[model samples]
Target: MKAALWYGKKDIRVEEIEEPKVIKGNVKIKVKWCGICGSDLHEYLGGPIFIPVGQPHPLTGNVAPVVLGHEFSGEVVEIGEGVTNIKVGDRVTVEPIVACGKCPACKEGKYNLCSLLGFHGLCGSGGGFAEYTVFAEDYVHKIPDSMSYEQAALIEPIAVAIHSIRMANFNTGDTAIVLGSGPIGLATIKCLKAAGASLVIVLQRKSIRQEYAKRAGADHVLDPNEVNIAEEVKKLTGGLGVNTAFETTGAKIGFDIGIDSLKYGGTMVITSIWEGEMNFNPNVLVFSEKKIVGTLAYRHEFPATIAQMSDGRIKSDGYITKKIALDDIVEEGFGTLTGPEKKKHVKILVTPDKSLLSD
Candidate 1:
């Protein structure tokens, strides 16, 4: 079997590797498609951040220089002992987060905050970049026959969006302003709309992304370079601002813009993972009674997102911009996804199994 291995900055290699064996209470999946995520790009550019220099993962205990990929879906090739819910030949998507159920956070039903929580790709456990990945049965969710593998690969990210929206707790008919037009931002738009948001205003700089956001169901798409986002949002809401704002660009300017676009007493959810701190005005938040909330990786939304995709409530086709074989993972997939062509690329799904790639 062949897998994409990460060593250090800009070092990704596709090499032959031993296939994983099914273990007790674990299922072995033949990876069909995996999406290149923003976090993966971050690690590729300058990392060993999540995977420390010489120390192993606190939970998984695997060291750095591991297989890299998590946003994926596959077909079960073998099932381990006592796993009765899923079986061979079943299509599935993994939730990725393997948490210690005994932790205080887990006990409180907040598994995302588990003290010993770890994920496959980031922690060195063989991940979806490989031909086959083995995982505990509890992390797998069955995908309906109606859902395509590319779409199934996206459930992980969609679940992230769903979780962020769930954190906001927006009421039906609340207006939302999303400060980015990347895959997650577009997914946020879809999630907000499905959550019954009356209007969604998307702020983006790139024309391609702005067009893509509108196609993904944003009520209004504005280019921040062309117009003042806060003023436009205020005009849209008749001098008031959006009830909810999502900051997904991970840019300091985007954060400021999102904050300025929020109505008094409104909620702002920071969904992007920023590596460094940025300056924000404390007085504005204090005076307006506005709240800023942060959302981490998802908890318990995979199956729900898959169900939504199967029922046509959320369409993944518009976001799946490219598909390539495992052999072409580095150049055609990762390169195009992170390079100057990023705006043109949304979700690039890589398939270890070519038969399933087209399916």
Candidate 2:
């Protein structure tokens, strides 16, 4: 079997590896497609953050230099003892978070915040970058027959968007702004529209991303460099300002703009993970009664996301900008995602099985 192994900063290698085997209560999947995520790029550039050195994961107990990739979908190849819900040839996408069900957060139904939560790609599960990976049966959800593998591969991120929108508590008539045009940001816009948002605006510097945002149902796409986004949003909303804003760019400037563009008493959902702290104005939030909320990964939304995809409601084709083989995992896959050429790229899917590659 072949897999993408993380060696260190800017050093992910594709090499031959032993195929994974099914364990009790787990199911082994033959990975078809895995998406290169922003966090994977972060780890590739400046890592050992979530991945520990000289030790195993605190929760999963799997160590560093493991197989990479988490956003993926595959076909079930084998099932371990006690796994009855899934069987061979079943297509599914995995929920990568393995949580300790006894934790307070898990007990409270907030498994994403489980005290002993461990993510598959990050902690020690050795994710879908490999030819085959095993996951708990409970973590794998069957995809509808109408959904393509690429669309199934996206359910994880869509669930993240769903959770973020739920955190915002957006109403049908609400006006909202999404401060990034990346996969998650654009997915947020799609979810916002599906939830009945009257107006959904997107702020992005890259023209390609802006165009993608428009195609993904953004009511208005603004280039921050070309126009005053805050002022334009104010005008569009008849001067009351947008009722909600999402800061998905993980940049100080994006954060500041999100705050400035919100209506009084509106909420801003920070979906991107920042590497460092940024200056935020406390007085503005205090005076306006505006709220800033943070969303982590998804919880219990995969089935609903799959349902949306099955019904052809959430179109993921516009977001998948590129597809590459496992052999080109370094150059054509991750390189196109994080390099200077990223301005034109959106979601890049990697296929371990070259037979599935499309023209």
Candidate 3:
């Protein structure tokens, strides 16, 4: 089996590795599609962010140079002992979160906040970037037959958007602003519309993402460079500003715009996995009595998110901009996504199986 391993910053090698075996209560999947995530790009550019180094990850016990790729969907090829509910041939998407059930967050059904929180792909347990990978059966959720593997690969990010909305307790009739129109940002826009938000404003720079923001149902798309985002948001919301703001861009400017675009008592959900620390005035929040909450990853929203997509509330059309074989992941997948022409792409799905490439 060939898998892409993260050596360090700016170094990812796709090498022939031993295929993972099925463990007790686990299942082995033949990966069909895996999207190169923004987080993966983060690690490639300035990492060891989620990739455990000298010290092993408390959960997966594996360290750096491990196989990567988590946002994926595949067919169940084999099952381990005690895995009864899932069986061979089930089409599925994995949640990919590795958590300790004993932690306070886990005990409270908030597993995404597990004290030693880690991810299956990023933390090195097993990843979807290879031809075959194994994981605890519980982390895999079945997808509807109506959905394509390419679309199912999007469930992971879509679940992220849904969870952020739930964290905000966003009201249907309320207005919200999404800062950034990247993969997660685009998903946030679609999820907000599906949640019945009356007004969804988008803050995007000059890129193809601006077009995606509108297609995802943003009521107003504002170029941060061309317009005063805060003032425009105020005017759109009748001087009160939006009821919620989703910070999907980890950039400082996006953070600033999100904070400034909120109304008094408005909630801002930070969904991006930031590359570095941010400096800001606490007085801003104190003055407006506003709230800024952070969302790590999806918890129990996987199933519901699939149902939403199945029912047509959320669609994956137009999200995937490119597809490449695992051999081309570093250049064609990661490079194209972060290079000079990055604006030309939104989501790029990589496949270990070449047969699917014909599509």
Which residue ranges in model 3 land beyond 4 Å of their true spot?
A: none
Query: Which stretches of model 2 miss by more than 4 angstroms?
Result: none
**TM-score order of candidates, top first:** 3, 2, 1
TM-score of 2: 0.97
Per-residue lDDT of model 1, residues 1-359, tens digit only? 98998888888888898898998999999998899887788788767666544887777777767888999999999999999999999999998886889989999888988887777777877899989999989899998888877778899888989999989988899999998988899899988888889999999886698888988899999887889989999999999999989999889988998889999998999999787778766998999999999998898888788888789887776888888888898898778877888789788888887776556
What Cα-based lDDT does every candidate model obtain? 0.87, 0.88, 0.92
| lDDT, residue 288, candidate 1 | 94
TM-score of each: 0.96, 0.97, 0.99
Cα deviation of 220, candidate 1, in Å: 1.1
* lDDT (10s digit) by residue, model 3, range 7-71: 99999999998989998999999999999998999999989899999999998888888899999
